[model samples]
Target: MKADFLLIGQGLAGTILSYRLFRAGYTVHLIDDAHPSASSRVAAGLYNPVTGRKMIKTWMADILFAEIEPFYQEMEGFLNQKLLHPQGIFRPFISFEEQNEWLAKSADDQFEGFIKEVFTGPQFPGVNDGMGGLLLKKAGYVDIPVLLQAYRTWAKSQGLMTEAVFSRNQLKRGKDGDWEYQDLTAGGLIFTNGIRAKDQGFFDWLPFAPVKGEILTLRQDFYSSKIINRGVFRIDLGNGLGKVGATYDNRNIDLEPTAAARQEILDKLRQLIPEKVLEILHHQVGVRPATPDRRPILGKHPSEENVYLFGGLGAKGVSLAPYFSRKMVDFLHSGEEPQKEVNINRFFKYI
Candidate 1:
């Protein structure tokens, strides 16, 4: 078979990149065995404008937020499913000092686009927000697994998705500068295989600090339509169901859900709300592809031609993937480069 591009992994990176390439009139084939522990499959998929305990604006939030909604809205049309949940996020102040800090930010013109309101009164029932909280707009979550499945169905119907394990042994460079992978030949190849990219021969030199995360789904009687985030977050899933958690553990980088992690989430959840946990519906574990710089790595390989990588999104994959995917597509199509921060050349000296 012949195609314009060959992509590895069907995770968020691959799914978004393939969609962009397909829309750009390029025929791309994606290969994935669909690992059950892939981060995209278990991600909470929340995209927030403000992040971290400091509550600073996320990197490139202005530019990234502009592209996120429209991108997912288009994906909703293509997938024929409601995947984008546009409900805003609520972050409660942790202390009186934090509350005063937020009150100061309420008037700051820099936060005008994202801050919906700063409430000093009670925000929700069965809640513990005596310190008040900040309502942030243009922030929400995506149903990643649903979107991934939809992409799979669509890609399979288009004959652009292949379910197979990708091995470097199956890859060869043709004399004409095309990549020959098994029975398929392509003008270029991209690896979007998340942490597995560290194992690839070409990208092994890239700095990857993989971290394990644990999350939980619970059945509760709370009736909030917005996301509540403190140290941990609780996203209202409707129907007496809510999703809570995500504990980061860089030391124990494994895919097993431990009771310790569960207790950690519960501890954090207790600090935010007064609601009692009715039951634990589900527990999930996935490894995030984190980098030391905490920015995504995008661009072609240093030594090889027409070979590229798009990953290291960490916990912010939902926020970063869509925007970077377009950059990757533009680079592939016209050699347009992404910003210096996310461009892979930032770490070229290490490699």
Candidate 2:
């Protein structure tokens, strides 16, 4: 019943963090309900180096790529599963202006290292695609569900997992300045509870802009066997399967996917190709734990000495989690501070 750390939630953050802690020789007990969500479970797990409308490489793509290149490979040897794949995304130009901008940026030294200089001019096999799009050279996808499930199975076999919802009421702030759960106690606990942390008592002070994302999984036989990279992700998906995602809805009154929303994805997908026959295989939804400034939440709770948290990874969990997790783990064990952007205190007026 006692361990070194009590981890809440088993999403990508928890999964990676738990694995890290375990490797570091710490006993970690993970607790979660394992419901479906688009953040990790439903995410396409695409790692886009440059993002946004301009299609620029993401911040620190080079450093993150170096740190991450072998990180997943090290884990594959341990887990005996292929968790990360080195693939590129073909972002089809959405507009004539976009095409112009892509060409202009391709020569820009700012994007030189992240994206390729030349791409096969817009052409598709029988399927008309985009006008033109930049190739995300270093981008890839992490099979998050496989990673989650593999870690879950591993953690359970090690008796470090529990299938249950973590409630704050189960916590007791003791006079010893350590968190308490039942008769066991740890150095402290971290609230990596994903979107559910918005309701967490004292942690409520953190600003979180929850955005719902939806993805549709399709079974296609004719799609290119290779990872068909395209704008918004039209991958070959391999293994007689493909996943098309995603639409962001911050103003959704309901949490369910709608016909219009499904059509919206279809409409976007059709812009390039002659609308392929896409059947509604399955749909999933999850609230992304976003922030006003689009950074991750990491560090200790302000007033709670030993209590800590690691959440708000947003849509970039696949690309950002491993690097940031190492940073947070370093901070937790060595008192190091998080990077300026990911430092959770930035969003909090006072932490």
Candidate 3:
């Protein structure tokens, strides 16, 4: 089989890039074994313009937010599924001082697009927001598993995807300076395999600080329209169900859902809201492919021709993938250079 590009992994990074390349009229093939612990499958898929304990705008929020909704809506139309939920996010202020600060920030022209409302009092039932909170626009979660599954089904029907473990040993350089893997030959090969990239020969020197995160689904009586995000996040899934989560632990890189993580999440959940948990529906864990600098790594390999990487999205993959994947497609199709910060050339010194 011949293709313009052969991509490794079908997680968020790989799936988004492959779809973009396909849309650009390129023949692309993917090799993905469907790793159970892949971060995309386990992620809550939240995209908030304002995040963290400091309640500041996320990195590249303007550019990233601009593309997020439209890109997901396009994918939804293609797949005939409802994937993007633009329900917005509500972050409660920790103190009166923080509330006053945000009230002042709401008037700043810089925050015009993202700020939805600055509530001075509690807005919902069964909640604990006494000192007001910041309501943000252009914020929501993506149903990542549904998106990946639908895209995989479509890709399979088109003969663009193969389900198998990718072994580097079987990959060889063809006489024509292309990549040859099994019977497949491609002009270029891209590694979008998430944390596995650290061990994937060509880009090991690039610093990858993997962090493990765990999320829990619970059956609860309390509900809210907006995503309640403070210490942790609570997403109302309707029908008396809600999803709360995400404990970050960089030391423990394994996929196991620990009791400690569960307790930590519940503790944080308590701080965010006063909702009672009726039942614990599920608990899941995934190790995110984070970088020390918290920026995505993109572009071609320094020594190997036509080899590239598109990983290091970390916890923000839902927001970062679409925009950066478009950037990557442009780089691959038109020979355009990606920005220096995200371009792989920045790390050539380590290589």
Candidate 4:
């Protein structure tokens, strides 16, 4: 058997990259055991242009946001599912100082496109926006699990996916610089295996700071079309269903959803709104593949010519994966180099 690429892991990174490669007329065989708690499987899939405590525009927001909606919409059409939610984000002001700062930023030319409204008075009712908030455009959440499952079903039907664990022992380099794994021989291999890569031998030299996060799904009377983001993001999932998340813990390197995290989110939610939680429908935990500098890991392995790595998307996986996947696919399909920030070659000296 032969393929243009043999991809490891069917997480969001692998799924998107495989789809992109397939669309570009390349054969891609994916191997994944389908872990029950993979990060992509549990992600809320929020894509916001503005982020962080300082509340500034995300890096390359213009480029990343431009590719996001169209890319997810294309997948939605292909999968025949409504996975992309186009609701804008509403971030409440924490202090009068912050409100004043945003009022000034709203008039800035840089934020003109993404800024929907700068509320000097109030934005939403039945909420704790006494000082008002900034309504941002071109931001929303993707139903990641739905999209991943749809893609998995489609890939299985096409016989392009194998459900199994992938290890270095199964790989052998051919004389022509291709890779051979079991019955198939492929040109190259790419690893997008999330936190599992931390223990993988080939990538141990690369710095991976795995951060655990927890989120909750609640059934409440608070039904709003817009996503409210303050300390924690509150996304309305329709039909009195809402989602609030996520606590980032870099120190606690475990997947258990702690009671502390739950309390933290609850406290933050109360601070945002005075709504009563009807029921705690679900609680989930997943570890994000983060890095020291919080940039993505892309490009081929430094020593191995045919092996590649793509991850370190952290909390922004939903917003970053699609755009970077296209860039990585182009790099592999041709000799195009990824941007200096995300390219894996930046850490060559440390390795």
Candidate 5:
């Protein structure tokens, strides 16, 4: 088989990048093992403009937010599925000082687009927002699993995807400067694999700080249109079901869900809302391919010709992927240089 590009992994990074490349009129083939612990399958898929305990604007919020919704909506049209949910996010203030800070920010022109409302008192019932909170626009969660499954089915129908473990040993460089894997040959090879890239030998020198996270799905009666995010995030999945999560553990990097993590999330959920958890529906765990700088890595490989990477999205993949994947596809299709902060050239010194 021949293709313009051969991609590794089919998680969020791979899925979105391949989609963009295909839309750009490129022939692309993917090799994905369908790993159960892939982070995109287990992520809560929340995209918030303002995050963290400080409640400050996320990195490049303007550019990323602008592309997120429209890109997903375009994908929704292609797949004939409802994937993007722009339900908005409500972050309750942790302290009186925080409340005062947002009250002043609400008037700032810089925050005019993102800030939907600044409540001085409790706005929603069952939520623990006595000092009020900041309601944000253009913030919501994507149904990642649904999108991935839909894309996988589409890729298979088009004969663009292979389901098998990718072994670097089987990959060879042909005399024509093309990559040869099994019977497949491609002009370029891109690695969109997640934490697996850390041990992939080629780009292992790059610093990768893998963090393990766990989330839980619970059966509850709490109904809210907006996502409640404070100590933890509570996303109402509807039909008397809501999802709350996630516990971040950098030290313990494994796929197994721990009882302690579940309790931790439950405790944080209690702090955010007074909802009762009638039952625990599911528990999931996945390690994020985070970098020390907390920025995604993309662009061509340092030494190898026609080799590239588009990983290290970390916890913000839902927001970062749509924008950056377009950037990656452009870099691959043309000779465009991605932003220096996210470009793989930033790590050339280490290589």
Candidate 6:
């Protein structure tokens, strides 16, 4: 059986790319084991225009969000679900330097596109230590677990998805520069295995520093319709439940969520709304596929043209993934050029 592409893994990277490929009239065969460590499953899937203490806007937020907005909208409509949220994030500023840096960046012309001067008074009492901060417009959350489930079901129904974990032993390189796996042959193969990318054979040459994240679900008042917090993220998950995340650890791979991380999250949440009633609903941990350079490793394997990869979005996978997936598909389909910053060619010399 001939296929345009054989996509490995059904995480955000694989799902988004395969979905777009199908929409673009390509025949794709997807396979996955649905590992719980998949980042998309545990991700809060929030998109903040500006991230980190540097107070800089996320790399290419306007362009990425613009292209991705309609893509997710179409997915939601197809699934008959609301998968994307346009709710803005109001970050709590804890230090004077934090507020000052935000103000400095807000003054730049680049930031004007995404950030609106946050003039609103504190909606959450005791939030930000009375330090007002910036509001990034048109940024919000994606219900990643919901989207993943919906996409998986759709792909399964279409006979485009398989339940097996794609094995390297099953792959055979053709003499003509292509790949064959069992009864299926493809012009190219893409590995979107999330944190598991480190375990892949040919593509493992790229640097991947994995990070572990732990998130806790907490109960808010059922009447609380607002998504406000200075902590990691605050959202209206409905039925008095809101999810707060994510503690970062570089060394641990234990998927078991810990009480220590839960306590840290709760403490941070309290700084924003001190007197609020809450309950710990659940906690979960997942591994993030972080690269040494913090940019995604995209491109073909050094010795093979058919083997390619799209991993290492770190914590920004929810926001940056859709755009990069589309880029990878285009590059594979039409020989379109990828931005030098993200292409794996930069690391080829070292590898």
For model 4, residues 220-324, the per-residue Cα lDDT tens digits are: 888788999988889998888888999999898787889999999999998887799889999999888888889999998877788898888888998999899
Over 161-270, each residue of candidate 1 has an lDDT whose tens digit, in order, gives: 88988889879989999999888999988999988987769898898888899999998778788899988999998888988989988898888899999999999888
Over the stretch 9-34, how does candidate 5's per-residue lDDT look in tens digits? 99999999999999999999999998
For residues 114-168, write the lDDT of model 3, one tens digit per residue.
Answer: 9999999988777788877888999999999999999999999999999999999
Clashing pairs in 3: none
Better of 4 and 5 by TM-score: 5
**Model 2 TM-score, 2 decimals:** 0.91
lDDT of 2: 0.74
Task: State in Å the error of residue 334, model 2.
Answer: 1.4
Return the lDDT, model 5, position 128.
93
Residue 145, model 5: Cα distance from true site in angstroms: 0.3
User: lDDT-based ranking, best first?
Assistant: 5, 3, 1, 4, 6, 2
Reference-based lDDT, each prediction: 0.90, 0.74, 0.90, 0.89, 0.91, 0.78
Alpha-carbon runs more than 4 Å astray in model 1: none
RMSD of each: 1.1, 2.4, 1.0, 1.3, 1.1, 2.3
- Arranged by TM-score with the best first, the candidates are 3, 5, 1, 4, 6, 2
Clashes of each: 0, 7, 0, 0, 0, 0
- The worst-scoring run of ten residues by lDDT in candidate 4 lies at 194-203
Kindly give the stretch of ten consecutive residues in candidate 5 with the minimal lDDT sum.
195-204
TM-score of each: 0.97, 0.91, 0.98, 0.97, 0.98, 0.91
Best by lDDT: 5
Q: Which residue pairs collide, candidate 2?
A: 49-58, 50-56, 50-57, 50-58, 93-132, 128-272, 228-236
Task: For candidate 1, give the lDDT.
Answer: 0.90
